[model samples]
Target: MSLSAITLLGAAGEAPTLTVVGEGVVLVPADVVYVSITATVQDENLTVASSESSEALNRTIEALIEAGVDEGAFTAGRGRSVSTIQTASRVCNNSTCVVVSDGAVNLVREEVTIRFDAREEALINRSFEVARSEGAEAGIAGYALVDRRAAIAEAREKAIQNAEAEAGALASAAGLKLGERLEIFERSSPLIREPSYAFDPLGMRMTDLFDLSWPVAVDPFETASSAEPGMMEVISQVFVTYRVSP
Candidate 1:
């Protein structure tokens, strides 16, 4: 809801505890721009289909490089599949009809996609232009920071401090004093098996993930798509329980 979500619970023999959920978020510019090219081709012969795809892919890469994109900035892939196509039609002669022989042929379909980091402003715009001129689909895949873990580390500290501040303020309003933390929990990403940062209440916090600088791109791509890295979020949240003196 708000920046903090608070809850209160008590038991017969234990001190009343206040639990609050705090959140932190940071917006950072994109460090890298991902440019992509895709080509879809079909032919009766698999060899021909693969060749067609390769030709289109090569053309796009060459154009990108010629536009000042280095070869080291490229990533590419290709895939192939086969399916049957119907060609023959039924023929009838005075109520006598015969099934056509060899009415189907194998059609090979191939797909190729080339990706690259168009880190420079000049190369970034040229990437989309090259893909478009070469008869290939042109688009930007995404933008991201180089150091995501460092961003998360900063957010984690803010969330913890925010939780503590909210608890203290709410405790004071209720005529009680804030005490030591009883339990600490981190709300991490479900998709991530290993979190970027961890908490240790034993006076030993993870130091390797923090105190890092993420330099912004020298020339940020003006949001042609309106969905640039400026919208990306490096966020952290926590649920903290604290004892409240009666």
Candidate 2:
């Protein structure tokens, strides 16, 4: 991407101005991992469905706490309930007609988000295992860096240095001495790319039962252990204008 800026020196005076855009990038390993666990229950009775779903969610939370996850690092979202209806279809005279069937069920679902230290692989694995054993579906959500502000600051400084170096080089090549800095503008900041778990389905039953909305070619659970930590890049850009001395 390009950074652009405009500057006028001394109210349109005849002094030459140099404007340059510089970019900086840094790559870092993620320090934290996030996982979202969802528990679902369906029954003909709404009360039973809601109760079972809540119980399952509570068990999952307890299991995560037992697996050494800090309670503060996890959050439970509001529970959702929906009424699902079953329909029967009949084709007669090259036309299809649908009729509502007696088969109707209430579904209740609750979700919990857990944050784990990336370095603690054992605890992370155990947390997933316990959640799954407690009738919850678990999957990797994303990853994050611990010191994001520091990384961004470093990248921004590098961008400033790069702009200065380019400006000086251009001035020297043109037989002109670099003068005072006129203006500095931060065009962009570093961006962190979160890992996607949209395509990963841990178990076959999860794939078969849930409305994942996409097809999974591989089992995420079988390959998650071998998967490497998430990688992210920080990028910064700045536009600078400087005065020129003849």
Candidate 3:
């Protein structure tokens, strides 16, 4: 059919609120992966601990970059903090004043973060393995895909198409031809859920009490293949006003 001919049949004088629901669905492969990891250090002396922590974190960051992570993925902490070891004081009921004994505190923990964007799913899987093996000591916080706008849009169209199909079916069953829609509206946002991260306790742990240093490794495996794909769904509704033949 000619474009003009089709448009002429569906033209509206004012704002046309055709209550005809249409649904459509489209599936697109996940295009990005994100990794979150933290580097931590600990020691008996705050100064010494801070220094060692900084050094270790620097090494970890260097390792990630050397392993192909970009500089943009590396993020370090603001400052060093002296974490105090505190014990609750006890008061004794006596005629004399009780001696207050506050114990000395000695300990420091330094932390840094590392992240990367994965364009290739397999590459992402490989990066996970590299992070754990080389620099990840405390292990990865988790991983995820960002910006799902495109997937949602696809699902929304599918949902609208589904609604339209239902409306047409009902009209056909009643021996009536579907007519102009008076109003159409989206019911809700499309749902898109995807699995982002998985953990293997055996692959991650903590060590080096003085430095609070540890090594982390991620298995190079096809996460997408191993895991089930998340669902994307859409929903919409439309109202139509048709003139029935007497």
Candidate 4:
């Protein structure tokens, strides 16, 4: 049920007033998406590990550019390390499997990541496909809105308008003339059902990709990763109080 109230708030400090809450919603397409491709290698020799990782990383970048993604869109990835080195320990017993010695690193692992922004749906799908084919793990970082402030402002205006209209209807229903707005309050927030892959850093949802009515990749010639763009939802709520004329 909607929240509403009639209280004693008047010109003489004791008259009837009507209060109501209103909400506004706005839907906007996703303007950009964050994509990450990481090439990882593990070997007993550090040089070999590092060299192979760089090769895989380079292949990923070349494939993305060849697939039509802008080279300038790429950025240094933020994760483990650009040149991170870790150590491996020796296990003493098979049953216990305890670290017997903290000796020199028996194995070395290297990870190189590259991140970029994709504006077009086809490019985003292509980026994922090409990166994965090049022996790199690919994933979506998150969805973003370039015009976030504008969308919020429009939703707020609609909320205020809706509050006024509802307040007027309530006052007239109680056999009183709608006078003037006594008070207005706003504590609204934008709400969206964004997935937690960016939050968890492991997986993403197809909800954004399939939620919209973009064409499914059924054609043999259609280059795609079987995904599409998603939308963002913005909402604002407002409370308004109006004094009634007897």
Candidate 5:
């Protein structure tokens, strides 16, 4: 879709006006993936809940580090606490109702985010496994392209070309000649959306540490040995404006 506006130049006394607006879009594959690891603990004791949640998060972070992920690639988010309530209701013979409350239990949750190149599929999968085994939940949050600026620039050039073509067609239809460029305005910025992936362990059992035949391995840089990686989309949009003469 496209739109345009006309503006008179030179102190509103000019005979010629400028007509502008053109848009272009492009799609590219995402090159990076963002993974989110969450740890949650619920108990009557706030301290216990918080401690357990923190430990789970720490374990996940350590696993990622062991998998060859740089320490800088992970960020810890703010911790959150919520009250879980339990309620009981009783009905009397006269259709009257009485309600009793058992008070509230505190639940604490913490999260860590990991950013890495999508090519590190094995490492990403290993991180998920480690987080889950540590009693945390892990999933892919979204995907991103490494060089968004370059993609936007390419899309912008295409948009300008589109605007020129439209201007030429409009000028021809109006029995006028396309003139020199007067103005270029961007209608909107580039739009990109990263797709989310749900975690599915596929019933893979955790290797038993005591089983020497299937000994637990500790490698930080290893990618997923089995699971397939996911993909995301990157979109770029550009708008342009030009002038015409009779």
Candidate 6:
């Protein structure tokens, strides 16, 4: 369509063929949370320790399952055993002897992961209790909401709108009429985290160590890893190209 036609459509409230990029954002509230409970068992006898740890892990998993937790949300991994080795050398008088030495490391750990929806706060609370009852410690691992596809689309539209306005203003200032949209390039808001929150939870109390407060900040653009949704800024950007009519 011609630039004049584009202008006319804009004036008449009709969809213009001009490459108009719009952006919109919607505040989406999260309604669900993911809770992860980890248990570690250590004993002197590797066999007895491993067996007991396995049983504890299983009981924890079964408890979660019995509470209507989704099977996909639960995981029971094999317990790991670790041993220490040492080497020593001694020399006396004119005779020297090399002795290979090793020490026994008696330790075993079992881990279980459970994921459940927080549709009900009471249910979440109950889950925590159940975990404790099963001799496992649990806490609010993370929070998530329903699919944000629609919200993202809305944000994309708003971005397109902003681009279109800029393009129109540019064309008007350049004394050239606006033309049809030649091309539109868009990318989804990248799911970004913060840089500071990266740590391995190897036999550590993850919940006690990290904070899970409100105002979850996520750049959605910066590609980083944050422990708790680093700073809560969800943003999207878009690029648009339009033709110019003489």
**lDDT of candidates 1 onward, in order:** 0.62, 0.71, 0.46, 0.62, 0.64, 0.55
> Candidate 1's residue-wise lDDT over 63-132, tens digit each?
8778877777665555566676777656799988876765555555444443344346666777778877
lDDT of 5 by residue, 6-82 (tens): 44443565545446555555556668888988889888888888888888788778877877888988855654656
TM-score of each: 0.60, 0.68, 0.48, 0.59, 0.69, 0.54
Superior candidate under lDDT, 1 versus 6: 1
Task: Decide which is better by TM-score, 3 or 4.
Answer: 4
For residues 151-231, write the lDDT of model 6, one tens digit per residue.
Answer: 566666766677778778867876878778767665445232222344433322333234222112312222323335412
Model 1 lDDT, residue 117, Cα: 41
Rank candidates by TM-score, best first: 5, 2, 1, 4, 6, 3
Best by TM-score: 5
Candidate 5 is scored at a TM of 0.69
Is candidate 2 or 4 superior in TM-score? 2
Model 5 CA lDDT for position 113: 80
RMSD of each: 11.2, 10.2, 13.8, 11.0, 14.9, 10.5
Per-residue lDDT for 167 in model 6?
76
Q: Which segments of model 1 are wrong by more than 4 Å?
A: 1-15, 42-46, 79-119, 165-175, 180-184, 187-230
What is candidate 6's TM-score against the reference? 0.54
Candidate 4 local lDDT, residue 43:
61
